[model samples]
Target: MSEHYEDDKSRAAKASFYHAYFSLKNILIGSYIVLSILVISIFAVVTSKVTEQIITEKENRAVINSLRNIDDRITLKLDNYGTVMNSLAYSESTQTLLKQASELSNQRQLELVNEVYYRMNEVNVTNTEINAIQLMDLSGKKYTLNNGNYYMEGLMDNYFESPLYDQVRSLNGGLFIDYSGAYSRDTNNLTLYRTINELRGTRPIGVIAMSIKKQALGSILFQDSDLPLTSLIDISGITVIDAQKELQGTESAISFNSFTDIASSFQTPLYGDNYFITYLKNKHYDYTLVNRAPIGSIYQDVAFIKKVNFYLILFNLLVVVIIAVFLSRTLVKPINELIGLMNRVRQGNLNIKMTNPPLNEIGILANNFNEMVTTLRNSVPLRKEQLIGKLLLGRTADSGLLQQAKELGLPAFDSAHGVAVVEINDRSNIDASGVSIDDVEILLQSELAAIHSSALLHILDARRVIMIVHGEDEDIVPYLHKMLNEQKNIPVTIGVGRFYASAEHIHESYLEALDALNYKHLFDRNGMIYINDIQAYVYSYEQLDVLEDGIVHAVKYMKEEELLSMIDKLFITFKEQFVSKEAMNRTIVNTYLKIFKLMSDRGIDLFGSEQSNIQVPSINNIHLHAGAHELKREFAAFLQSATRLIEERREKRMNETIAGAIEIIQSRYADNDLSAGNIAKELHISENYFSKLFKHETGVNFSQYVTTVRMEAAEKLLRQTGNKIGEIALQVGYNDANYFSLCFKGAFGVSPGKYREKQGN
Candidate 1:
């Protein structure tokens, strides 16, 4: 309406610029002429809008196609450099020098260093785009080859930091290119960072940096234009490259920084004339390519044609003026009827109808307009409700919705906005009688004043209620909690979402409320939870995955003490991080189930004969899982029973292994080469593993068991066969008579001769 008023005022000023004629003939002629001019003006305005859209699309397409072609060329060039860098990365000798340049001897290093320099020279010859290549250690200390012939850089602070280098490090290992000043020495040159890793491992051992000079970049960097100036702007809006060296003043006229809300593709005005602009961003390097040309240059031919048509229309208007007078009278009659009907509609009435008056386009238009008015009147309430729903859900189109909301007088949504979720617990379910959902909503709205509420939106259900509130203070969350806590009539649980500054984030607040409500069991006594207080614990809960894996490993290995330590560690972390009680219960139960699954996969059962008397509680039984401490006690007992069963399983396997080893040893006992190592080798077990199992299963060390078997054989030979000590020693597996007599005496606490005499030989 304001725009319409301004247009009327503008026309009134234009009419005052003309002289008035009072003669009847001239007045009638002038009035018809003026009316015809108004129709022609409307035609021109509509034509201009269509032409503007077509021309804008045509120029934007032409410029963007050219920019994309240039972008593709640059990517191709950079890809070649990347391929070369990857080739050098896979070179085994280069990788070895990167890792152990300090470990090589001086003479060997010099010779090896010359070979690397020769290789680098060969690479430089192959790829001339590479201006310089330097290899630095992981600690950023530069290593020179052939006295700085190939690698010449010294230490760089913070391991070569710059805009591009920071991007490369954050991405781990990739081709890093910078038209921006990632290199300190030369901003004109593009810097490259290629992280080189060990040949056989994924560990990055060093970085190789290459510089490509701007001279090598050529005019292609700026698209090499002639008429319109071309420029390459960095991310910081600095013009780094200019194609038209003659038009260096392009910077003074156009500054992208002036348009902070610039779109990816948009036009900007320069000196009151539109400059057709297109946007192309480099996906790899992250700089914007802007192609700009004046709108006049693009539409010059169309402007000439429009001027010719306007002159022709003016000449025709003189001949058509008399005929237009008759037609205008006919057109104005139905239009007057339309004006009256519109006035009725503007006064809030849509029941008026258009009778069958004429068989022309005007009457048909009137009929369609009448139907449209009726439809709008019938759908008013439904549309308003839909808009309100959109506003509450925060799914509104901002400018349009905000304007409509203001006209409809919706509750203001601004900085201090929060959401509260109410859930009916067992106590609440038993006592929610005689209270309608509407009554509850009214109660909540009335109670919101304690929070200094300005507005509210609510959805109530039998089991749950969601309320969105707006307040003036930052203490809105605490006040809402206080109100809900003081409600003794309803034994409900409340979850309050954190406040947000805009209505668009209201959905985020609602999601927070829902998540907080999921942890209701955590605050059983308080019956309320605030998202901000436990948000950190929600993130730290992911660490439980590592803890669960540790528990599984200990349980699988039958390490009962280690398993207990892991459980304590899990609970300690939960306490330290202040993880909610619900989260703790859920994670522990999940981890315990995983432990049982691993044991079941190994064919160990918790309900087997060994565990028949043990009864594990279910998840719904809260008495057994009041908190982490109580849960830990119950879990420890279950783990102890599992450990005993696992130990029994291990013992059976250990007995079979030990019996097999003893059989192999006894069969070969008389052989003097028989020893624990040989016995373990015959049994096909690791020596260390066999020793531990032997000692654990037999209650004696490997060597001690072997010696006893040999000595017993020696005693039997001495007592039963009257063999000489030397012969008995040789029979038993000792190498000499003195050694055998010493062994026999060591076993009997006397010499072999005395033992033989005492046996009455």
Candidate 2:
């Protein structure tokens, strides 16, 4: 009885569990179907909205582009018309005709006016857009021609009476639009579009006006469409305001109010019962372009889009139903497996392999997934190694590995005994040929060759190349010399610093290299220099003062030969005291700084412009420890430029002084005691000093200058008066007649009698 009851209870429990499991499965399926419908509906609405926005934006752009195209065409036509008018109005023949017309008889004047009209008609006929051409004088008188026939009497005050006339007149030269009714002809209802251009002076001479056909402008507004559009309405709300149509045209009388009310009542682009109204603002005319498009006609495309969207939605729903069924079964397992693989990969275990079980398409997908993992596993190490190498060579800044390197306490330098900074001067001239080499490559090759060992090289910046060399050899000089000579074509300068014991002291070596390079200007052709060589070239500060005094003395005395000799002596003394490249460079750079400073103190600008306002790099930053030869060459070039500038300034000052002296001499030429000695005494200078100064300033001696001035006065007196030669000579500060005659002969290259006879007195 107990066994029977237990079996019955077990069967009942099994039945209940299966029934509940099936019910849960049905509930999950129903939830999925409802969620999927909601998601698909949301996606469809978003997609439709996005598509509509894109289409609307594209249409707006198309409209703007079309308007711009039309505006460009009209602008071009107006520009061409203005150019023709400008050419004719400023022509030499037109000026000549106008000039002749003023003085000619009434009959001749009429003929000349007719000729001018004929010329204008020819220009108009060539341009089909131009209906008529008219020329008007400043007095509001118009002379118009139509098909070579002249109309002289019925002159209208079109531009002269308009408010735009003064604005056009103010341009002085160039064309401006005159919106006033200037030349309104009857045929074709053509109204005047005057392009008034002024002559190249203060006065307004004439105006050029064209009668533009209204139909030509209307065609531009409407273009290839069946739509009705009216364009170029003025600020006063008038259509066809600046039109070329005559007063008799049917479209000319159409008021701006007729369209302005209808356009204003509708939202910018109003689609109405039969037509859609739209308007574009014309910036050139400061007006509006109004158009009316057939409403049902223009929106036919919009209606088609609606119909297409409805069918697309129905088709999309069918696709969604199939996609839901397929995705529900396949997505969960593949997605879970992919997540696991990604987690393993992220953890650096790229060896993770996915299993391919034969069940639907998941087997094929699993095979592809395993292949991807294998490729990634094989490539990661190689890429990481390559990336590390690139970072060490300064090709990249790998912050991750760099941080790791720092944390691991990796040595910044390999067992380097010393650091050297090698810089390539005139790097811009480097030949970039094989391997896309640049100035940096030239520096790298030169440094490696110089060290002749596996030294670490780094590009610090555009201007500096740094290297660390291992070993304790004190005589790195020979290697440096050979390296520089070998790479002479590159024109690189190597600055070697004092050897440091460890990597941490590399900064000290860097400073030494910089110091050595700074003193490079003291040397000649080979600029390879070492910082330790500077002590040999040290000099007392007093010696620099002596050098300054010597330079100034040479300049003041105007002794070029003596200056050259002094410079040679200084160079020889420097070479004797300091034989190394560093010493020579330091001396050269110091000398330049001293000279420039002296000039600055004396209020002399070495750069020709305002030196005070100019900012130069700090002197410490300037690489001076280049080889002695390079230092010397750079200094020499700088000195040459400075010397030329000084000479220019001196010449300008001398010219001013000479001009003043000449003015004084000319004003006091009648004074009998106006000799060189007397002039020197008056100016408070020695007679000899004055003579030298005068010759230097004017390329003439003081006595010769005085004689020349006196002779000029004598010639002027002889011409203006019936005076004897002796009297003229005496008046011009020549006392003794015989002495004056000799002076006169020297001054004129002839006797006073011949000079006076040559004057035709």
Candidate 3:
């Protein structure tokens, strides 16, 4: 009996457990459906709000843009109106009409007035907005046209007091909106656009005023839309005018006041209320276009959308419940598999493979996961290796490894090799090509790798290629030839150094290479030269001194032909003496050093000490080891220095010559015949030389100096004695009285007569 009871209890417990599991499943599904409905409903509401806002903003912008377009059209019309009015106001007939107004008989005057009125009426008929047009004289007289007839009235005593007349008189041309005019009570209140212009040269004519109707202006605003909410007001909060009509009664005043207050504050538009206002201000006219529309009209669809959204939420909740049940069952197996695979990957078992089921979406996700794992596994080693390489390279500068070669018995120099300094001229005019500095350096290193046995290539301070080659090579000529031919795309030239036995002697070799390279302009072919070749042909100090003496003698005699001949001789001597590569380089370095020293001594400061310090050391090495390649370099440097020195000396000597000439002129001031050409002839110099010299020394040309000196003498005579103006002119070497007075007035900022009076005072 006890065993039977136990079996029955076990069956009951199993049934109860299954019931609880099914009940929990239903609850979870139901909860998911409810949450999803809530989320979707919230999303629908937010989307509706965003869409409504976007539509409202876009509508307001469209309205504002339309108003601006209307303003532009009106501005253009006004400008055209101004042009026509200007033409009419300046017409000869209008001047004639004004002149005959006061003297003619009533019939004759009316005829004259009608002619003027008819002309204006013709303009008015063409411009429909211009209801009336009139011309008023400065005396405040009024003239009106009635049914093709002209009627004239005597000057209105209070006409000048009107704001329209005040604006017309003050500005000569203006536009005003008049509240009290002949047509004010009617729909056609006056918008007087006036212009004042001169007639017959001397007469200050009255204004030609065109009175445009207020209703016509209102028609411009109402033409596009029948919307009852449009306004135009000046910036001062005054309603210049609007499309709304003024209603009669006690309520009218209150309504108008409310509108005026609202318009003033509605400078900027606001939203979300029952009304939406869009406003645009005119930059030229002090007026604003205010457009108001009902918010309900813009977003009328929101109410229908809200009701539809509520029903959609209910329908979506029902669908969500069904989808949740299926998704929970379907996602369980795949999620378990993904979790297992992730665990394996985390435990360093990256090679694990999972069978992809025939479910299309799940199969794709599995494939992608596998691909990602494979990529990360493969990339790890490569990234580690790259990091190591970067670490090593970063520890040293680009050229730091070359320093170690010297310690290993390889040749190195503190000074630069002149011939090895090849400037890489940029011939390709492309502003930007994507080539990087690393790419250029890599290319250079690859091309120079084979030559590293005898030479070390380095990038110098500038964008120059510097090559330090072994000076001991029996035939560097082959290497030089190979470099020139191989590096054709990159123009290169070599300055070979004399053979040196020790690393310390590398400086001498460097100098030789530099010297040879300096003569690159002279050599058309790839070649090499010994340092001894340069020293043999360079100019001695005595030779340079003799050249200097020749230049001085030529200038002293004021002989242009002789001076030119000396320059030619100097060039020829330089060519003959230092034509070799080594001589040329030595001469260049020496001349540069001398010029640098000269500038330094004279406090000119040609170059910074740091820059000069580096350059001078390199230059000294080239000079110490003179070579055949340096000859051309030496001659070029010598010529450059010689030219500069000669020019400076000539300038100084010319100044001295001019000062002497000036003294001669001052002593002979009484002689009116004293002139530039005569002075030059007496000094045994050419007239051109004399003129140049005079200008250089006195800061004035020869003729200008003579005139200035004579003028000074004239000033003294005018102040010291009461001489006649004509006599003063003659004393100052001027034969013409007018010419002298004119010159005096120009120099003193006053007429001669005025100047004499001021002096007396």
| Model 2 segments more than 4 A misplaced | 1-27, 96-101, 125-128, 148-155, 170-199, 226-230, 241-266, 269-282, 285-288, 294-299, 311-313, 316-721, 724-761
Model 1 CA lDDT for position 87: 52
lDDT of 2 by residue, 1-761 (tens): 89999999999999998788668776788676666666666655654565455444433433444455456555656655654565567554455444344666778756766776666655552455665566666555555655333232333455566565765566544445423322342433334343333333345566665565555656776673533343455445544522233322223233445444312312233322454444566554444555444545545555654555555444546675664565555655665786688687665566678765446334544554575567555655444433333432233233454434333233344344566776666545553432212445565566556666555556544556665566554455446545554744655567887776544456567667766776555555446777777665455444544444445445433445555555665566565555444444455556667667755754577565654433332446345433434444444445554555556555675765466667778888878777777777777878887778788876568777778778767756866799887788789887777788788787656787775665457
Report the number of the highest-lDDT candidate.
1
Models ranked on lDDT? 1, 2, 3
Candidate 3 C-alpha lDDT tens digits along 599-713: 4543344355633422223564564433333443454434344444544554655555676786776676546687999999989999997787677665579988887777666
| Candidate 1, 1-761: lDDT as tens digits | 99999999999977765535455667888887787777666555554565555555645554665565566556656655664565555555567667887898877766655666666665452344555666677766554432232222432335555454566666555776656444535555666777786653458888776666554554555544522454566665655555655432224355656444332456679668898666676656655566677778777745854664465347546544643575466556776787788788766566786676455545655655576576656755545555554554455544567655544455556566777777655544545465655555666667666545655545534556776666454355455455655654555667878888777877777778877776554455436777886645444554676577657756765778878888888877775676766667777777778877876865676676866776664657643443455567777887777667766766675687898887876777778888777778878888999999898876679777777788767756765897778888878788888987887677656798886775457
Task: Give the alpha-carbon lDDT of every model.
Answer: 0.64, 0.55, 0.54
Off by over 4 Å in 1: 1-41, 106-126, 143-166, 199-201, 223-228, 244-263, 267-276, 294-302, 315-761
Error of 2 at 247 (Å): 15
| TM-scores of the candidates in the order shown | 0.36, 0.35, 0.34
The TM-score, computed over Cα atoms with residue i paired to residue i, of candidate 1 is 0.36
| Total residue pair clashes for candidate 2 | 30
Rank candidates, TM-score, best first.
Answer: 1, 2, 3
RMSD of 1: 23.9
Candidate 1 vs 2: which has more TM-score: 1
Alpha-carbon lDDT of model 2: 0.55
